[model samples]
Target: MTATDDAAAPPLDVLIAGGGYVGLSLALALKRGAPSLDVAVVDPAPAGAAARDGRASAIASAAREMLTALGVWSTLEPLAQPVEDMIVTDSRTRDPVRPVFLTFAREEGSAAPFAHMVPNGALVAALSDAADRAGVTRIAGSGVTDFETGTAFQRITLADGTTRRARLLVAADGAKSRLRALAGIQTVGWGYGQSGIVVTVKHERPHHGRAEEHFLPAGPFAILPLPDNRSSLVWTESTETADRLVAADPFTFAIELERRFGHHLGAITAEGTPRAYPLGLMIARRFVAPRFALCGDSAHAIHPVAGQGLNLGFKDAAALAESVVEAARLGSDPGSADALSRYERWRRFDTVQMGMVTDGLNRLFSNDSPALRIVRDVGLGLVDRLPGLKRRFIGAAADADPSAPRLLRGEAI
Candidate 1:
């Protein structure tokens, strides 16, 4: 439970690399889902310096449900923003082709929300608290400098030169996962010709807890609502254009963004320095290698058009943890090929399908052909008009179902 517990504690059943939201959240989920096992999280941050901030994460309803199962969602509710509705439109077209808007609101009997926007720091803090409560040991300033997968366990050499041997090695690191690379997990994908610029701006008008996707000719111009009438923006543009924009001064940057942003939120002012992340779709050829498994952005990274990138990672985490915990309950080796493959079987199709959908949508909506525009808009409107289809879409977003693993269904795995 304490930082020193990393070395003094007993050998771990799971050792997670990367202390980011995905890794920490997964560790917390595993600890809460299976208390009989010992888990240790190895992150790069220095010990006792836990009050870190400046990062942000968008937690979807599905993620909230998973966190609720881990018993960490209640503490995070205060720092979260609930998304009530979503509006979709074309930025440049005058008539906007076929207008369509979708709302993931609770019509009736729907107890879960659509999504939440939470500060990455707040979520990390909550997870740390939850991990401590679950008696999961923390290993700070200890990232894997080298990792070797043995027949029975994976051996990790940390920055401090201490070795960690675990039955299951989980890679919850970011897009460039060192553990994955060390395991020689080949990834099959390439970078997009674009980059996504993320920023939180203070708008002149209240967002009313609504999310907006202005499908501009270049890419998606999304505005996700925050708590205090502020909104987080994910503006995707060509790689060249994004580079130029981020290098621009705040005044110049806000002016250019305002022009593309229109008068939807009235006058908007930049609240922080804009950061750019290159967009891409990368899927591992295999989700697991021997005694190792991949989770979060380490397993796959996709375009954020649908804002489900992190949500999908959480799904992977929940499913992977569930698979292992369930196997443990059945007196099975959770790290074996069969058990890990079960986790893969549950996620591969869904993850790959989402990648294609988001990638295709990014390409389709970014084109300016008048015919394509009209056809896609009409398709959008059609989907919006079908109530049954709308419910299906909403249900899919929340990931609520019996076939889903108990952990993913808001039940202990």
Candidate 2:
């Protein structure tokens, strides 16, 4: 689709505010699921900018399947690194050595690995390309400035002062979504007083697709494998400590990193400038408002302890797409209260459940209480010993929820 001035553009069936992964995927999914529907995405970032974000995500098996069903996974598969095993340990930041308390290997009978570490850029690029091919319009370098919902359609005002209309409006904006706030959606959450320091490190030896999580007093530190003998570090610490570490000189920063990183992989060097983000759990009290719906971080943002945040957003996109498409197929108004309610009902409980799980895990593990530590370690050991239980845990991490939407199950809407 050729770029046209927003003023002259026709009304859209769905107008999504945000061009991140969830927004792009939702647009593509909708177009693919119901070709007759008109969809467009608006974001303040220039076109292709999101594809340059310097981060990676763990795509659970279910999310991978959804991407494959959307015909974008093949494009990303080449750059994706499958996770073959995962090890968990609990220790202090200054511990001489952290002992693994739990380990999960590739489960038998599973066609795909539990998850794949995929660069966010590659995934976004693939989805963007697919959306373009699917004839979805993208309004770049601008965002929804305001909107007025109506019975039949919602009038939208763009940041560039262009007005357009849509049957439904979606907020796939980030956790601090301006659109969501403007829609008067209240959120419930709290800051963990922790921050996640992110960086890519190149190790002398290959990781062989192993991921590790060390539960330190401050939070969990994760080393997720990337392609080319590189691994992404997600080091969690007190907010102040994280800020100080990231701002420290190269030598000091490297020293601190080494203290937590250990020598399991031999010598390591930082691959890029380190960045830190404050940790928090924010869930919108409601996922839908009038003709508007929330997807991705706009609806819920959880701790990265389980590496399921991105996958949760994908689930939201899949479920919302399926709901809207199925409604249209039934000759129902896609933006009707009944249709939006279904999407809300389908996702709210699952999202809440994940939020509670991650929150509880973070609270249980991010501490130095001796009694709590012993209890958690024992729990981890038990889970590791129980093969059936381990498989179930792995399956859950892979987004194998039985009530998953058809799109998430790799089924056509």
Candidate 3:
């Protein structure tokens, strides 16, 4: 259904708040899996805003498979840079030598790399375009202002005074989800007092598809490879320090960036304005309530130390869509308690496990304690030396779990 026809349209089966990659993908997945369902997405950002985003993300293999199954991966593959290998180092900012304690390399003749780095703009554009082609109604430039869940539907009010009812209202509206709060769903979380500075950097030399994560006193400084002679940086620091650095003059900022970025890339230059996002660990106390559910950042927000934030969101999208689509196929209400419970059950353990992992990693690595450093470094070294264990770790991150959603396993729902 097009936005033009929305006025006369029937109540939707699913109304997703937020049109980021997660929301868009979920809408597409639902429509593709069950075209009879009415799906729509609403976001405050104007249409085409995603095309201008300068940030990038690491798409795990499982996410790539889901995109492929949805027929969106081919369009995105050209803009993606496969991660050939990764090296992890632990050291202080000024340390002359940052020793690589752990390394993960793609095996020869491997079917695919574990992950690929793609720009945020490209990803969202592809997902949005595919969603449009899939007949998913997209209402941009408006957000859900208020919502009330009735016994049969969720009455959602838009900022523009538009009212729409949906059997299921999925809040993918991000970490500070207004819909989640409106649903009386509390979140268990705390600010880490750290902020991640994201910036794209151009380098004279190619990265050869290698990603790096350096554990510094402030936090993990990640250099994720992108296509061309560029890389995306996620530099974490104390909230106050991050704010100051982002406001620093270009020259001063570049100097400080170099202190952590190092000279390996050679003649690096910032490509866009640096932005800092406060980091935290947040998980909604309940992922569902009546005719309401939460996905993506609305459900759980984790540290980017492991670059799993977006992948986790994709996981939620796939899982939730699978549950809803299956219910619809069975002639049951897609938003029924059974369907919501299945989604929550399928996602809860994974969400909490990842949240704890990221939180623990941030605490263990984002400090200057001498004793802790030794222990973590030794642990990393031991894991690196064990090929079987390293492969298992890579498989886990790549979403190789056999019980994952059909879409994540490169199959249709």
291-315 in candidate 1: lDDT tens per residue?
8889889989999998888788888
- Please give the CA lDDT of all the candidate structures: 0.80, 0.92, 0.92
**Stretches of candidate 3 exceeding 4 Å from the true structure:** 4-9
Per-residue lDDT over 195-267 for candidate 3, one digit per residue giving the tens place of the 0 to 100 score: 9999999998899999999999999999999887999999999999999999999999999998898888798
lDDT (Cα, tens digit) per residue for candidate 2, span 174-208 = 99899899999999999999999999999999999
Highest lDDT scorer: 3
Q: Order the candidates by lDDT, highest first — what do you get? A: 3, 2, 1
lDDT for 386 in candidate 1 is 94
TM-score of every candidate: 0.93, 0.98, 0.98
Clashing pairs in 3: none
In model 3, what lDDT does residue 71 have? Answer: 96
Instruction: Give the residue spans of candidate 2 off by over 4 A.
Output: 3-10
lDDT of 2 at 355: 96
How does residue 169 of candidate 3 score in lDDT?
92
